[model samples]
Target: MKPNKHSIDFGKEEQYLNSDKFVDQIICGDCYQVLKEMPDNFIDLVITSPPYFQQREYGGGGLGNEDNIDDYINNLATIFQQCVRVIKKTGTIVFNLGDKYLDGNLLLVPYRFAVEVQKRNPVKLINELTWIKINPTPKQNPKKLIPSTEPFFIFSKTDNYYFNKDAFLEYHDKCLNNGRKKVGNEIGKKYFELIDRSILSDEEKALARKELNETIVDVHQGKIESFRMKIRGLHALPYGGQAGGRLSQIKNKGFTIIKIYGNSMRKDIIESNVETIKGNIHPAVYPEFIVQELLKLLTKEDDIVLDPFLGSGTTAAVAQRLRRKYLGIEIHPEFVEHAKNRIRQNINNHTLDIFI
Candidate 1:
């Protein structure tokens, strides 16, 4: 059975880390202590943005408040190892780390931790996805550029990690319609002209026209947003450098068409407005949309999603909305209440459909 909607500050060690009794609970304690109680292979996804070194005042002197750079990276690496231990072999971890400036030089803190995590843990570095902040905090220093991006490192113990690619593309298909090319009424006109001009037999031209008509029908049905038909002698080779069956298809068929649903070319970068709040208990509250995207990409309904850093409980709220079980661990007491309230409000105010 699913746990209650509200967050729970874990206490009484006897009842802790029990997935059935507290599947969606937020354990309000040091993650180091909380992670120790979690069972191996318990979580399917661990997506969280931990405290960056000296960036914010995350109470309880957690990983970020260390005295030096090495200490900070070491502390985060320790958390990374623990998270890997709790996650299943098929699980995936997405840890977003922000960079900092020290002594007028940009400290590569995020990369440092990533290197250390790979060195100490038995995991593979899958992707270093960059997050471009649309509205970053204004910096008054004229000599340095404004800091606006962060890195989300995807790690997994094995290649069997669960990734929902169709669900991911479906979201960007809806979210990136404005950025995609238009499927105009004269979409297939140019292809027809190119086919007529190409050096092909009448039989080849007939085949190309048939395929072009089918492709345009797909655009009208919203199966795809656009297409590119490469007719022999009329256009360059689609696969000049790549080795695939596509090269032979152009040699034998005289034409080939590429279908793009929408935003299929956009990869490895996330863009969202910085969620800057005034007098907030948790200083840095990440954008909820980013969490939603990651959850959709990495998990399915009823899968366990863990956030060791928890912060203001963005993961828990998104997990609940997506019908995934969540386990959150936070250090501060006041932020625990803030996270619980946020999750409660999200559940009460909005209803979300499961991943299609």
Candidate 2:
């Protein structure tokens, strides 16, 4: 008999802390059952790329092998609904779903799932990002355009959520491209006084003014730009105040002012040349960089990150490296073992080898 959802004990605060040791570990079982056992508003972030419908066959009742596309989407939505119960109101969910082609037609599985999920739950559809696969497996169709991109749908349990803009600022050096030229203009304005009437001498002020004008000209003229704006009077901007303005914008002159880099981060496009996972039975293993970006953006240190479709444990491994607690649920025992061993290897940095 199945255990009652409410009856599942959360114990006292001390006991809960002891049991919270379940964090950073993979529980091999059905996702629905395991998620039902978890406490409400327990997870801070949920990032996972569940198996695509009818994409692959991993023995022992793997996902993505549903009878129909609608069936598969509905099933996935049901699991995510359970995830919503455990996810905090301020939490976020980033699901990376790929599309499939049937009878020479494209099926928008990712968007379909997004709509279905929102319809069934009270979550908000926050953002829609695209993951362009630079090196995707060659398709048999030369007549049709080669498949190269996937949809990354971001959802929030509530309108207000926690987002760390600085987490994905790895390429900060070349962030201020033409996309953020308006930011450059704003920076020029903010520092106008420093160049106009600062505590510096006449000669020093003249030199500062020249430098500021040159930088602004460079920005307006579509010259190379970076996030490190050398100006005075710093003010915050949306999506990371370092830039002093918003992201990409198009001017009336038909030119796109693109901020190639931000003090906080880059654009929605995550460039990935898929790398093969060695000795992994699962057909699809999420790239570590992808998981890292999502975790950093949606979670904080020691926050609970849950992955219901824990195929090969990419999310778990990345979460461990990021120092955030992780909870993974996988139905297949073999895949579960794969995830556990992978996590162990990543954490120890020592291979499990025998010296006989």
Candidate 3:
């Protein structure tokens, strides 16, 4: 799909506004107004970690108010409403959120956002994944337990969205040994013929010869050595007894060939390892890994990704790295500057270019 020219120009405008001589630069401004200037259905994904209500003092138009959680929900819903309008029909929205504490009670902030988002009726709830933090910060709470984990809420604009499942497959063809056996005998004979005719390189012949031996060994281990004589025509030596026995045992353990295709579906949400950031812009800043995953799963190349309340520009940086156009709104100038610098550094590293 072609990217919207307007959005591309807007990204260029950000680069020019910064006057940093860097392409695809981050803009320092409020995301809502910036997003309003952008055309609708331009973004492929909206993956963001917004500030939790009254969590910390972000200095400029930050998340505030302890008296009314309902008001917070309403404000969040308004931001998401704008997000829904700009996001493409095939796009996805992932909110990495958590709960808050109020009067010794755990406030269901993530759930509240979920309920409010559902009221829009245009988007569908995909999954509520639990981001299990392997090593969480220890805290002493006299009345209740310290919070350790957070919620990553996945939402989609339509039932049919962009998800490349095979992109995350763990196994590769190099991990497969069974299929190599069937072709070994034929390949070995061809190799010997080519070597005798001086039509193949020594390295090529050696690799083919080794494959032939491994195939014979595999057949013997599988107890299907009826064609051993055919394979023996290549005059290959028997594999080392101990090593062959170990290979047989390894094969017996069952070589699982996990074929990950483009249609692979993942229902589980991945977690990011907690790491410290340089600045204390906010108490909770999401890891770049989490944002990168969302961008890969939800958006397409050159598609716009919006982040209202972009705390530290984790979303923007990830989006830029993945070649997706991004709009990040931050009320705090310091955070905006931090996010802009982070993106500028990424651009200098050539990690934020769409063409790259």
Best by TM-score: 1
Candidate order (lDDT): 1, 2, 3
In order of appearance, the predictions have TM-scores of 0.84, 0.71, 0.63
- Per-model lDDT: 0.80, 0.70, 0.62
Q: Per-candidate RMSD vs. true structure?
A: 6.5, 10.4, 13.7
Worst ten in a row by lDDT for model 2: 247-256
Stretches of model 1 off by over 4 angstroms after superposition: 1-22, 175-185, 236-240, 243-251, 264-266, 277-279, 350-356
- Give lDDT for model 2: 0.70
Q: Tens digit of lDDT per residue, candidate 3, span 57-166?
A: 56664344434777667656766777778777887777777687778777889998898789875888887777767667777777666677888887888888887654
How accurate locally is residue 190 in candidate 1, as Cα lDDT from 0 to 100?
Answer: 80
Please, what are the lDDT tens digits per residue for candidate 2 over residues 1-356? 12232221223122122254557878776676666667889789988888887788766564577667766776688788888898899999889998888997888888899999999999998777677787888978779888888877889999889987656634333353423545434755656664454444566556656665676676565453432322222322235554333222111111112333223334776767665777887878877766777777788889989998898998888888777889898878889999999888876884221111
What lDDT is reached at residue 176 by model 1?
61
* Candidate 1 C-alpha lDDT tens digits along 121-237: 999999888888999999899998899999999999899998877665466576666555666788899889888888989999999999999999988776777888777776767
Which portions of model 2 miss their true places by more than 4 Å?
Answer: 1-21, 171-265, 350-356
